[model samples]
Target: MATLADRLDRCYSGAIYDVMRDMGLRPGVLPRTIRGLVPDQRVAGPVFTVRGRPDPEVDAHTSLLEWTGLLSRAPAGHVIVCQPQDDTRALMGELSAEALKLRGVRGYIVDGGCRDTELIIEQGFPVFCRYTTPVDIVAAWRPEAFDEPVTIGNVTIRAGDFVLADRDGIIVIPADRAKEIIARTEAVIATESELRRAIRAGEDPQRAYLQYGKF
Candidate 1:
């Protein structure tokens, strides 16, 4: 399987942005809680996603160790995308990030909060989440599920879908539509590039946008 980086290079992040715009999704940074923890780090990959919900039963638990095991064994170049049921509480922290980095995992995307933002950003590991908190998971939450469909913002993410995120925002490309999206996104990029060049060369920006469908 092609790594996320490899596929992204072919289609380009700008192209993905175009697709997202075409789909009527507003692009904004996910909440600041998600951050990177490695030097010069950015992660892009097909999402091996999981979702979790709060459980009152203390015994209803899924071990992070087990999840790390899957990360370690995952095919090289895949990302572990996680969606937490509770957006207000931190679910991942420095320890979990350290294990993921060591396992050669790409990065994480969560719709919830995370701890250790400073260390994570200093280390340069890429994480995207909703908020940051000082909370821990000892009694607050549990990882009760894996490899399931999850929602982040307005996007529905499935276990095997392709995810591309950067400074702009994250875009989810369905597994079955990957190839088609890639092709369309590439075309959008080319069109926009030409329009940009024309505008830079003194052509009317409005005319360019009207002709190309985007500025």
Candidate 2:
């Protein structure tokens, strides 16, 4: 059997949203402003939550130490989702992206800005954020907590909850329901495939949708 990450990577955001809707689950989507670094850079995995706060009084060296410590603490095979309360400076940069990627972090998503966009793009590390900036979190930010619930848009994301993000948008599934959600999404995709086939085979689109119960 494929792992949840493997199954999720094969799933797209739209179909997942549809499945969750049919199940009456909240559409745990992030804000539209926060988006992937590169086009078609889809990411799906269990999330490692990171939250930060402004610390303007801290010295650069101390702030950097704390930041690097957070980097070292991140585990492999998980996407890091951050809620940096500060909005001006970037929470992620070239070295940070490289370090996380080297350490096997699947990807990163932040509800703030990012820096070193060109280099990060060159590295091909998936980073979803609201915008890009040259300002960085040197002495202005500090890691507040991890694995705590953080709200990005209308959804509260907890650690270990699964996320599916693509060109359309990002959606979160409660950890307890992730597997079931994926299974349902796979079934939805399969049904959609059959629906497509019938329509292409000269069947009326409306009739095919009625026959397949999906459009």
Highest TM-score: which candidate?
2
Which stretches of model 1 miss by more than 4 angstroms?
Answer: 1-5, 9-14, 20-42, 56-75, 210-213
lDDT of 1 at 33: 42
- Lowest lDDT sum, 10 consecutive residues, model 1, at 27-36
| Tens-digit lDDT string for candidate 1 (1-215) | 86445666466455776676676755333333444433234557777877766655444144444444545554445677777778567766786777677667677877777889887776566777767889755544666556777766556777777777665456667777666666677778778789888998998878887888886
TM-score, one value per model:
0.76, 0.98
lDDT of 2 by residue, 129-206 (tens): 998899998888999899889989788999999998899989998999998999999999999999988988999988
Worst 10 residues of 2 by lDDT: 35-44
Compared to the true structure, candidate 1 yields what TM-score?
0.76
RMSD of each: 4.2, 0.9
What lDDT score is found at residue 103 in candidate 1? 68
